[model samples]
Target chain A: MLSIVAALCGLMLVATKAFTAEQIASNHHSYALKTIEHLLQQEVPATFSLTDLPYGECDNYIVNQISAAGYVGEIQYLTVWRAQQDTLSMRVVRHSETPGIGDFIDHQRSPWITQFDFESAQAFTTLDGVSGATVTSNSVRRAAIGALKTKDIYCG
Target chain B: MGEPKTKQTRTFSDGVLKRNPAWIQLLGLCPLLAVSTTVVNALGLALASTFVVVGSNVCISLLRKFILQNARLAVFVLVIASFTTIATLLLEAYAFALYMKIALFVQIIVTNCMILGRAESFASRQSVGKTFLDALGTAVGFSIALIGLGGIREILSQGTLLAGAELLFGSAAKGWTITLTDGGLWPLAGFAPGAFIVAGLLFALVKSLGRASTEQPPMQLKGES
Candidate 1:
């Protein structure tokens, strides 16, 4: 009975996964575009161009996957950096950081991430991290600095 | 031994009030407090939880006779987990923005004690029809508790109601936001500590109301004199 139930449950999962995969992918694409537009402070042009970066870039917006050692584990996020403007935006794609305290890294959770909006790489150096979440703050800071370094390598 | 049948309405009211899983039983407080910062988020989690609870309850009740005592819990977990995954997938496809905000809590529904408790104590023993009503009532009760906290927190912390209704209710709900104040009056209400404080207050209020309803005039007996 256990095996049969498990098999049935597994089949249902497979069917649901196949059914929703395309929609989920499209949702993710639109969300990424929204984030890019938010960072650029402009609407993403239809049929925007992509670059050869690891995570691919949208026109001037270079997207990089940065994994920084957070309070618990590596915090992975897609950083949208505009080399010309020296401004970058980060959206946490995954993390196991303590919720409530360390989750302020998520833009939806708090405006702490907004401090990075439209700010130059140099300005990030002096920015204060969230109180009581020093490790998380530093981890995000490292990712921002890493994005800045990427501008030098790819844009140059 | 077979138990006496209860009226469907009584079963439902028991789940929603007298035996409310959240307020009285205090099951599933994790997601209850975590994803209730906003009305939209609370509703998102509530709907996801409702789907899982109702789906798992019906499935478990139908299969209860076939499930052995030793393997009952394992089966319940599998069913609940499957329903939770289905809910997560649907939310991702249809309500992606709201899904992102409360995805973690939605995923955690599989482990919510309320659903598992119902499966063990009610669904596994009761008839499917009864189990269905119980599950629906519990879900509604849980939703009320979640939304109550969500509404209070959103108002106190952000000074608005349904500020991001669009995330869950679509484009039509974009105009649903009602600003009550300028926001940031009590920012702590948006955090975990505030959840606990507000929940404590709400529970206290519910307890007072419950006591009031139970209060009655003294009864006279023939031999009292």
Candidate 2:
């Protein structure tokens, strides 16, 4: 009985996955384009591929994935670069930092992540991290630096 | 022994009010308290949850007779997980922003006590129609608790209602934000701690309201809490 049910459930999952994969991928593509547009502060690019980065022709706008040595674990983020190679924005897209404190790196939870926006790479150096969440802030800072310096970027 | 049939309305209201899983039974409070800080997030999670509950209940009811007793829980988990995956994929395809905000929390619905409890306690034995109504009732009850909490928190913390109305209602609703106050918002209410504070206040409010006709007055509630 368990095996039968498991087989049926697995079939249902496979069907659903096939049905939605394309639409979900397209949705993600549009979102990445929107983020790239925001960083460039210009008309949405004619085309951009996340796999092939330094996306915009101007190269002023880039979104790169970077993982820095965070306090609890490596912090993974997408750093949006713009304007004379400054960080237009930094979002902690994924992280395993402590909740209630370190997880504040997520903009949905706290605007502390906004502090990195619009800061040039050189300017980012002198910035103070979030008081209580120093490790997370520093981790995000390191991630952003790496993202900005990397030639390969992850727009997503 | 086979239990006597329950009245349809009574069964429905039991899930909605008298035995509300969130307000009274207090099951599935984590998502109720966590993802409900904003109206759109609350609505997104609630809809996804309702989808899973209704779908799993249907599947569980249909398959109840053939289940091996010992493996019943495993079957239930598989059915629930399948529906949850479907819901998550749909949300990703249609409402990407809202999905991202809630992707982690929504996946946890597979483990939500309210949905699983319904599957184990009722859907496993009940007829299809009754289970369907119960699932809807349960979803409605959960939605009420979540939206109520979300409304209060968003209003106090953001100084605006439906602040990011587009996420759920689409581009047409992007202009739907209604600024309630020029007074500054208390940012704390927008975070985790504020959910606890607001949920506590809501619990007290609901309890006090329940007491009004039987044992109390409105003025007393104001002073008591």
Candidate 3:
């Protein structure tokens, strides 16, 4: 009986996934585009026109999605690396941090997220984190550092 | 408990009014307080939770006979968890923006004592038909509590109704926000403590109403029997 119930559940889950996968993907794509548009401060073209920079090649600007462990769950973000200046900027793409407090990482809520704008990744160690959201701040910092390290390893 | 011989008749009001899980029993306060900051968020969670509770109830009722008594709790939880996952996927697909706002609450519905409590106390013993009605009534009760708290919080915090209605209702709801005040009357209302204050007042109101209804007028000033 347990096996039967489990099997039924599995079947239902598979069916629901199959039905919603396309719409979910489309929604994610639109959301990503909107985020990129806001972060880049420009209208994205019909297709994503930003050149995808291959790793190991230092370029003026490059974008990479990185994930790091946050206070509540994984924090995924898009980081822009400007290797020539050793500066990085990031925007959170997805996270499960507590609302109101940790959510200050959002640029709309507070200017704290702008602290990452065009700053050396090492600056995170000296910067005072958001008063009540240290873990969330650290998560974004970790993601930024990871993105920088990736550039360092491949570009050099 | 022994299996009952017949299905028991119950009324919707019994769940919504007389024994509201949120107002009276206080079954699921975690998500209740966490996600009641806005009407859209509250309603989104309510919709997802309703689906989960109703689906789990129906499944559990159908499987009650086959479920071993010793393993029934595990089985019930498995069913509830499955429904929650499906609800999460559906929300991500249909209401992506709203889903992101209340994703944590929606994902944690599997642990909501309200859903699990109903399964253990009611669905495990009732027929599928009866269980469905019970689930609906409970869901309605929960929805009322959530939306009421959400409305009050949104009014106090944002000074608007349906401030982000578009997230749930699409572009048509873009203009649905009805500004109630020039600015927030109480910005704290947008936070967790605000949820507690409003919920406390709601609990007090319900208690007072229940007390007033149950209180009997003093017997005519007659000698004590």
Interface RMSD score of each model = 1.5, 2.4, 1.8
* Every candidate's TM-score, chain A alone: 0.67, 0.63, 0.73
Candidate 3 — which residues are off by over 4 angstroms? A49-60, A71-73, A82-86, A97-111, A125-138, A153-156, B1-10, B216-225
For residue B191, model 2's alpha carbon misses the true position, in angstroms, by 2.9
Model 3 quality (TM-score): 0.87
Please, what are the lDDT tens digits per residue for candidate 2 over residues A1-156?
888888998898889889889998888666666655655566654654666654553345655656787777676566666656545577665555655667778776678767667666655555578888888777766765676566333333
lDDT of 1 at B207: 77
Docking class of 1: medium
Model 1 Cα shift for residue A154 (angstroms): 3.2
Q: In model 2, where do residues sit more than 4 Å from their true spots? A: A55-77, A80-89, A92-103, A117-149, A152-156, B1-6, B183-187, B211-225
lDDT tens digits by residue: candidate 1, A13-104: 99999999999988877776677666556785677533333344534667766679999888877777765676777777666677778988
Better candidate by TM-score, 1 or 2? 1
**Candidate order by DockQ, highest to lowest?**
1, 3, 2
Query: What is the DockQ for all candidates, taken in turn?
Result: 0.60, 0.55, 0.58
Q: lDDT tens string, model 1, B1-225?
A: 244555778888888988777887788889999988999899999999999999999999999989999999999999999999999999999999888788778988988989998899899998998999999999999999999899999998999999889998899999999999996689999988999999999988987788788874322211100
- The CAPRI classification for model 3 reads as medium
